[model samples]
Target: MRQYSIADLESRLAPSPRMPVLFVGHGNPMHAISDNAFTREWSRIGADLPEAQAIVVISAHWLTPGSTHITDAPRNRVIYDFGGFPDALSRVPYPSEGDPVVARAIRQQFLDYEAQLDAQWGLDHGTWSVLVHLAPEPTVPVLQISLDYAMPLPELHATFARLRALRDRGVLFIGSGNIVHALGRARWEPHAQAWDWAVEFDRVTGDALRERRVDQLLDPFRTWDTARIAVPTDDHYRPMVAAMSLLDPDEDLSFFNEQIDMGSIGMRSFMTA
Candidate 1:
């Protein structure tokens, strides 16, 4: 990938046009309430993003084994999917409205997979945790599409690629998950040095993303040796793949929060340029 200066990247983007897709490495739930480097950056990014008609999030936290689902409620309730966190974290309410119309449109695009309109599950920490800082106002309608755990990586990527048309209709698509989320290998301490394998996997993944080599990332579990540790489960890494699938052939990508945290989790994030 060519190294594009900020000016070069900005010049390529259209003036106040379609929304850019975002792949956010939402590392810790605590970042939802804390005033940290990651949260501050999220806020800054949100401020810069153009207004959208609706927001669609593909979150790592929501997984359906056999099918895809999209939230279609009029309003969303925050789900505290993680325990042992502060009470304030659970109390943080996004109060974002749901777009049933947009949800139906998403389902129409995924009809081959028998996509369902879901009203049971609400926004999990993978969403509100980041949006609490990103779109703090919660005025725009928000919807979440679940990951089909049984689907192959390539198939999932192909399926998501079809949704790129939504961007033209003023939908802000966000794929929220960490690149290397090996919780079992994590050192739960501040300033913990990242593991060598974690760093290596992150570097290679970033290289693939920068070069727009989505095939390498689609099967990282077998393609990259370090993925055995860096991607113990596909849950976290799949969202990034879904995000990249939405990239336009002519679109460039810019990365931020390019660091590994807690010895194993990679906080590298990227967006369309």
Candidate 2:
């Protein structure tokens, strides 16, 4: 990939119109390098997208309290933030540059919300795994916003409301996490049966989104039947809530790769206008 200075990159990105927001159920780390159905769908999603100014990813793996972290280095590294993967997976690199100017813009925009620039945090599997399929060339500048683990659902929703403006500026805000993630239930069984709880939870969640019921969608733990099993931890599902809260009612929504993975986990990938 051709390396560009942060200034050069930001200058090129500033004038474009905002890209759509995506909520991707990025399942396992192995999907990063594998040529599977989900990977093909991700590639198709990228192929269909309009050019973006920059990408702000709210990945499931990086969570913090009150603060959002943005990568500001000129050359960002690929984080092998997973274990027990093949050595070739570790060797895979997506050397996308980071734009400090854009990072600063995000920081200033969320000044009251306490945004911080991190030099050390690189692209985790929640990021590169999906991006490797989304933008295989790795030419687009990328920044990641951390989930405030301590905040309530409403607070996170409000934060996303402030972030809605970035959509018009050509930045693609992506929330990458599974809607039905039960770590204990996920298995490699080729013919595994879909757990009833997982099915019910994913269906209810999808229905709520389709109905534009933001409140119901935000409070999944209360409204959904399988919150405990589906969302074993809030870290993986909160990012989706953050992204969904930013969507406009009039925005066009499309669900791609709408299926269950490992029998019970939803592998749905969706985009909003």
Candidate 3:
């Protein structure tokens, strides 16, 4: 892949417009290519939203420390980062353009933050899975801001605060991750079962978010009762923390596809006004 500097790519794209915020519970990568209830909810959510100028997705799958990467290439590739999936899954493609101008603008928001321009980082399953359903045309200019896994709660919240300004510029911000993700517990059960730990954690996290308990929501791994089981790993849940931070306390929040998947995973998604 040809690489371009941050400055080189920023000159190619246009500025963004004001857009809404979304916290999607992007389950298994299989959902990306398959048509199911979760995919239907994603489609509905996209239909309900106003047109957006650009989209910035904070995916649970893309985690880095200190610096965030922005893609400046003309055509971004679909990254099949997962294994043990069917060949059909690997063939699914979402051909979205990269917006370097928006990427630079986002980098400017973080005063002390380092934003790198990379052509290598493509759309991971966390991003393409939901986006395939949300923006099927793939015409929208898209950029991904990496999540710094090493950063503490306070720093993460501060970073998201900078991103809140993008909402007014018509850049749809989406955090893709499940609220309750325990891969070991996922089964082929017909109805969603709320494991004792999963239920408690999801409920508490929901309450904390609704009540505007920023601190608790920021660091669920340590504060929540079922932190260990609910999260287990920071891969999926971390993006929600970033999305939740961008939310307005007074905005009306709604959950989509609210249910338990398998036995433990929480497939609940949220939209904030």
Candidate 4:
């Protein structure tokens, strides 16, 4: 396949430096409390971040149909969305405030559509698992937007691009999901050998991101057989599109924890500078 380069994005970068978008590949929920390299990197990144107005996250765990919504609660209750995990994982706390200001701004931005204000919704495992390490004592207000695959392909990409502007305003946009996540085929061992298909899909994903090839990403399965196995369902993959949409061609992209955790899940992550 033909490749695009940073020169392509550099030409498209805005005059002002945009806020960095961090795409975190949050694999096992156990990492939330563990002091692994992934969590350590999260801690380092959090310390280096610019002061932000509010945080906006797109998590694989949050799914809704037809409409998109953002959390609007004052203090969100951590949602133990996963099953069969140890009871200790559920007891973890992430008592962060929700920003009504950013929530209203998002509603106004998508003014044409009635974006729902969700009070019942709160931080899911996708968000908290990483946030526990990224921002242990996050004083910054946080909000989450549900992923709606029902939107037309064109509209889905366009909306994500709109949110990219939030970076200039000091609003952090985080996408928390793995590059390759096939739970049914995962190896429970930390050092288990990665499946060949998982490794292939993960490499393609990183190459596509560095080149800003959204077309290949949106329809990854066309070329790579591993794509189908990697993304049997796209709940974990779509957030990547939304997160990478805002990245300018010229800005630097850095990746950390560039390895697969389980045999089936690639825990590769990147940030757009």
Report lDDT per candidate: 0.87, 0.81, 0.79, 0.81
Best by lDDT: 1
Candidate 3 runs further than 4 Å off: 1-18, 189-192
lDDT of 1 by residue, 1-273 (tens): 233354542332224467899999999899999997888999999999988878889999999998888998878988999999888888987888896666767776664767888988999999999998889996678999999999999999998988887787678899999999999999988899999999999999999999878778888977899999889888998899889888897899999999887898899999987
TM-score of 3: 0.90
Model 2 accuracy (lDDT, Cα)? 0.81
lDDT of 4 by residue, 1-273 (tens): 233344433332323445789899999999998898888988998889877767788999998879889997878889998789888988999999986556766665665777888889999999999988888888778899988868754467677776666677667889998879898899986589989999989998898888777788877778678888988888888778778776776777888889988799878989875
Collision count of model 2: 2
Candidate 3 structure quality by residue, lDDT tens digits, 38-73: 998898878778877688888888888766676665
Q: For all candidates, what are the clash counts?
A: 0, 2, 5, 4
lDDT score for residue 42 of model 4: 88
Off-target runs (Cα >4 Å) in candidate 1 are 1-16
lDDT of 2 by residue, 121-212 (tens): 87888888899889888566888888889888888888767878777777888899988888778767885777888888888888777888
Instruction: Score candidate 1 by TM-score against the native.
Output: 0.93
Q: In candidate 3, where is summed lDDT lowest over 10 consecutive residues?
A: 9-18
